[model samples]
Target: MSRLELSPNFSDPDAFYAALTEAHRERSEADSERINARLILLLANHIGEQQVLEEALSIAAADSEQPR
Candidate 1:
Protein backbone atom coordinates (compact mmCIF):
# COMPACT_ATOMS: atom_id res chain seq x y z
CA MET A 1 0.00 0.00 0.00
CA SER A 2 1.06 3.54 -0.66
CA ARG A 3 0.04 6.83 0.86
CA LEU A 4 -0.17 10.19 -0.81
CA GLU A 5 0.18 13.60 0.77
CA LEU A 6 -0.93 16.96 -0.58
CA SER A 7 -0.07 20.42 0.71
CA PRO A 8 -1.14 23.96 -0.16
CA ASN A 9 1.31 26.69 -1.18
CA PHE A 10 0.03 29.94 0.32
CA SER A 11 2.74 32.58 0.32
CA ASP A 12 0.22 35.37 0.80
CA PRO A 13 -2.91 34.99 2.87
CA ASP A 14 -4.71 37.95 1.29
CA ALA A 15 -4.01 36.72 -2.22
CA PHE A 16 -5.04 33.21 -1.37
CA TYR A 17 -8.26 34.43 0.19
CA ALA A 18 -9.08 36.56 -2.80
CA ALA A 19 -8.41 33.75 -5.24
CA LEU A 20 -10.44 31.33 -3.16
CA THR A 21 -13.39 33.73 -3.01
CA GLU A 22 -13.26 34.24 -6.76
CA ALA A 23 -13.11 30.52 -7.41
CA HIS A 24 -15.99 29.90 -5.05
CA ARG A 25 -18.15 32.47 -6.77
CA GLU A 26 -17.54 30.81 -10.14
CA ARG A 27 -18.43 27.34 -8.91
CA SER A 28 -21.81 25.66 -8.68
CA GLU A 29 -23.71 25.81 -5.41
CA ALA A 30 -22.55 22.41 -4.19
CA ASP A 31 -19.00 22.99 -5.34
CA SER A 32 -19.00 26.43 -3.79
CA GLU A 33 -20.07 24.93 -0.44
CA ARG A 34 -17.29 22.36 -0.61
CA ILE A 35 -14.73 24.97 -1.57
CA ASN A 36 -15.87 27.18 1.26
CA ALA A 37 -15.42 24.33 3.71
CA ARG A 38 -11.96 23.54 2.37
CA LEU A 39 -11.02 27.20 2.45
CA ILE A 40 -11.97 27.40 6.13
CA LEU A 41 -9.71 24.47 6.93
CA LEU A 42 -6.87 25.75 4.82
CA LEU A 43 -7.07 29.27 6.19
CA ALA A 44 -7.17 27.97 9.73
CA ASN A 45 -4.13 25.84 9.03
CA HIS A 46 -2.32 28.74 7.43
CA ILE A 47 -3.02 31.03 10.40
CA GLY A 48 -1.30 28.51 12.70
CA GLU A 49 -4.29 28.54 15.03
CA GLN A 50 -4.30 24.86 15.83
CA GLN A 51 -6.15 25.29 19.10
CA VAL A 52 -9.01 27.22 17.53
CA LEU A 53 -9.22 24.72 14.68
CA GLU A 54 -9.30 21.80 17.09
CA GLU A 55 -12.01 23.44 19.16
CA ALA A 56 -14.10 24.13 16.07
CA LEU A 57 -13.74 20.55 14.91
CA SER A 58 -14.72 19.27 18.33
CA ILE A 59 -17.81 21.46 18.39
CA ALA A 60 -18.81 20.36 14.91
CA ALA A 61 -18.31 16.73 15.83
CA ALA A 62 -20.37 17.12 18.95
CA ASP A 63 -23.16 18.83 17.05
CA SER A 64 -23.20 16.06 14.46
CA GLU A 65 -23.44 13.44 17.17
CA GLN A 66 -26.51 15.07 18.70
CA PRO A 67 -30.02 14.31 17.46
CA ARG A 68 -31.87 16.96 15.54
Candidate 2:
Protein backbone atom coordinates (compact mmCIF):
# COMPACT_ATOMS: atom_id res chain seq x y z
CA MET A 1 0.00 0.00 0.00
CA SER A 2 1.13 3.52 -0.68
CA ARG A 3 1.91 5.55 2.41
CA LEU A 4 -0.14 8.71 2.71
CA GLU A 5 2.13 11.56 3.67
CA LEU A 6 0.18 13.94 5.84
CA SER A 7 2.67 16.67 6.42
CA PRO A 8 3.76 20.15 5.38
CA ASN A 9 5.95 18.82 2.60
CA PHE A 10 6.34 21.96 0.56
CA SER A 11 9.65 23.72 0.77
CA ASP A 12 7.88 27.05 0.31
CA PRO A 13 4.22 26.72 1.04
CA ASP A 14 3.64 30.45 1.17
CA ALA A 15 5.18 30.94 -2.24
CA PHE A 16 3.10 28.15 -3.70
CA TYR A 17 -0.06 29.69 -2.24
CA ALA A 18 0.85 33.11 -3.57
CA ALA A 19 1.42 31.68 -7.04
CA LEU A 20 -1.87 29.79 -6.95
CA THR A 21 -3.76 32.90 -5.81
CA GLU A 22 -2.06 34.95 -8.48
CA ALA A 23 -3.12 32.46 -11.12
CA HIS A 24 -6.75 32.96 -10.09
CA ARG A 25 -6.57 36.70 -9.64
CA GLU A 26 -8.97 38.76 -11.81
CA ARG A 27 -10.24 35.58 -13.50
CA SER A 28 -13.87 34.63 -13.98
CA GLU A 29 -15.17 31.91 -11.67
CA ALA A 30 -15.39 29.45 -14.52
CA ASP A 31 -11.85 30.13 -15.66
CA SER A 32 -10.54 29.73 -12.13
CA GLU A 33 -12.33 26.40 -11.91
CA ARG A 34 -10.83 25.28 -15.19
CA ILE A 35 -7.38 26.11 -13.90
CA ASN A 36 -8.09 24.09 -10.79
CA ALA A 37 -9.40 21.14 -12.75
CA ARG A 38 -6.42 21.11 -15.08
CA LEU A 39 -4.01 21.46 -12.20
CA ILE A 40 -5.55 18.50 -10.42
CA LEU A 41 -5.40 16.36 -13.54
CA LEU A 42 -1.77 17.25 -14.14
CA LEU A 43 -0.79 16.50 -10.58
CA ALA A 44 -2.78 13.30 -10.56
CA ASN A 45 -1.01 12.18 -13.67
CA HIS A 46 2.29 12.93 -12.02
CA ILE A 47 1.29 10.80 -9.05
CA GLY A 48 0.09 7.98 -11.34
CA GLU A 49 -1.45 5.96 -8.52
CA GLN A 50 -5.18 5.33 -8.67
CA GLN A 51 -5.55 4.07 -5.11
CA VAL A 52 -3.63 6.98 -3.60
CA LEU A 53 -5.53 9.47 -5.71
CA GLU A 54 -8.81 7.92 -4.66
CA GLU A 55 -7.79 8.20 -1.04
CA ALA A 56 -6.88 11.84 -1.59
CA LEU A 57 -10.23 12.51 -3.23
CA SER A 58 -12.05 10.94 -0.31
CA ILE A 59 -10.03 12.89 2.24
CA ALA A 60 -10.61 16.15 0.38
CA ALA A 61 -14.35 15.54 0.05
CA ALA A 62 -14.63 14.73 3.72
CA ASP A 63 -12.59 17.76 4.72
CA SER A 64 -14.80 20.00 2.62
CA GLU A 65 -17.69 19.41 5.03
CA GLN A 66 -15.70 20.43 8.10
CA PRO A 67 -15.24 23.91 9.54
CA ARG A 68 -11.84 25.39 8.99
Candidate 3:
Protein backbone atom coordinates (compact mmCIF):
# COMPACT_ATOMS: atom_id res chain seq x y z
CA MET A 1 0.00 0.00 0.00
CA SER A 2 1.27 3.42 -0.90
CA ARG A 3 1.32 6.18 1.67
CA LEU A 4 -0.07 9.68 1.22
CA GLU A 5 2.49 12.34 0.40
CA LEU A 6 1.73 14.99 2.94
CA SER A 7 3.98 17.48 1.25
CA PRO A 8 4.19 19.88 -1.70
CA ASN A 9 3.45 17.40 -4.48
CA PHE A 10 1.78 19.62 -7.04
CA SER A 11 3.90 20.92 -9.86
CA ASP A 12 1.88 24.14 -10.03
CA PRO A 13 -0.13 24.45 -6.89
CA ASP A 14 -1.14 28.02 -7.64
CA ALA A 15 -2.55 27.06 -11.02
CA PHE A 16 -4.53 24.22 -9.50
CA TYR A 17 -5.88 26.52 -6.81
CA ALA A 18 -6.85 29.05 -9.44
CA ALA A 19 -8.59 26.43 -11.53
CA LEU A 20 -10.45 25.01 -8.55
CA THR A 21 -11.55 28.42 -7.37
CA GLU A 22 -12.50 29.43 -10.89
CA ALA A 23 -14.72 26.39 -11.10
CA HIS A 24 -16.83 27.80 -8.31
CA ARG A 25 -17.23 31.16 -9.95
CA GLU A 26 -20.90 32.24 -9.92
CA ARG A 27 -21.90 28.82 -8.55
CA SER A 28 -24.49 28.48 -5.81
CA GLU A 29 -23.61 26.85 -2.50
CA ALA A 30 -25.33 23.60 -3.45
CA ASP A 31 -23.74 23.51 -6.88
CA SER A 32 -20.33 24.24 -5.45
CA GLU A 33 -20.82 21.47 -2.91
CA ARG A 34 -21.73 19.00 -5.63
CA ILE A 35 -18.68 20.05 -7.58
CA ASN A 36 -16.48 19.45 -4.58
CA ALA A 37 -18.00 16.04 -3.94
CA ARG A 38 -17.57 15.01 -7.55
CA LEU A 39 -14.00 16.23 -7.59
CA ILE A 40 -13.14 14.29 -4.46
CA LEU A 41 -14.68 11.09 -5.77
CA LEU A 42 -12.98 11.49 -9.14
CA LEU A 43 -9.61 11.99 -7.52
CA ALA A 44 -10.17 9.08 -5.16
CA ASN A 45 -11.10 6.85 -8.06
CA HIS A 46 -7.96 7.91 -9.89
CA ILE A 47 -5.84 7.04 -6.89
CA GLY A 48 -7.40 3.57 -6.72
CA GLU A 49 -5.82 2.87 -3.36
CA GLN A 50 -7.98 2.12 -0.34
CA GLN A 51 -5.20 2.59 2.20
CA VAL A 52 -4.15 5.97 0.90
CA LEU A 53 -7.74 7.17 0.59
CA GLU A 54 -8.46 6.07 4.17
CA GLU A 55 -5.37 7.88 5.39
CA ALA A 56 -6.49 11.02 3.56
CA LEU A 57 -9.99 10.74 5.00
CA SER A 58 -8.60 10.36 8.53
CA ILE A 59 -6.34 13.37 8.10
CA ALA A 60 -9.18 15.46 6.69
CA ALA A 61 -11.47 14.48 9.56
CA ALA A 62 -8.79 15.38 12.09
CA ASP A 63 -8.09 18.65 10.34
CA SER A 64 -11.76 19.60 10.53
CA GLU A 65 -11.38 19.66 14.31
CA GLN A 66 -8.61 22.21 14.09
CA PRO A 67 -9.28 25.92 14.54
CA ARG A 68 -8.81 27.80 11.34
Tell me the whole-model lDDT of each prediction, alpha carbons only: 0.71, 0.93, 0.97
Best-matching candidate per TM-score:
3
Which is superior by TM-score, 2 or 3? 3
List model 3 lDDT by residue over 2-61, tens digit each.
Answer: 999999899999999999999999999999999999999999999989999999999999
Candidate 2 to truth, TM: 0.90
User: Which model, 1 or 3, shows the larger TM-score?
Assistant: 3
Q: Candidates' TM-scores?
A: 0.43, 0.90, 0.95
Tell me how far candidate 1 lies from the true structure as C-alpha RMSD in angstroms: 10.0
Give stretches of model 1 more than 4 Å off: 1-30
Candidate closer to the true structure by lDDT (higher is better), 1 or 3: 3
lDDT of residue 11 for candidate 1: 77
**Model 1 vs. true fold: TM:** 0.43
Error of 3 at 34 (Å): 0.5
Task: Give, for candidate 1, the lowest lDDT window spanning 10 residues.
Answer: 1-10
Could you arrange the candidates by lDDT from highest to lowest?
3, 2, 1
List clashing residue pairs in candidate 1.
none
Return the top candidate by lDDT. 3
Backbone clash pairs in model 2 (N, Cα, C under 3 Å; residues 3+ apart or in different chains), count: 0
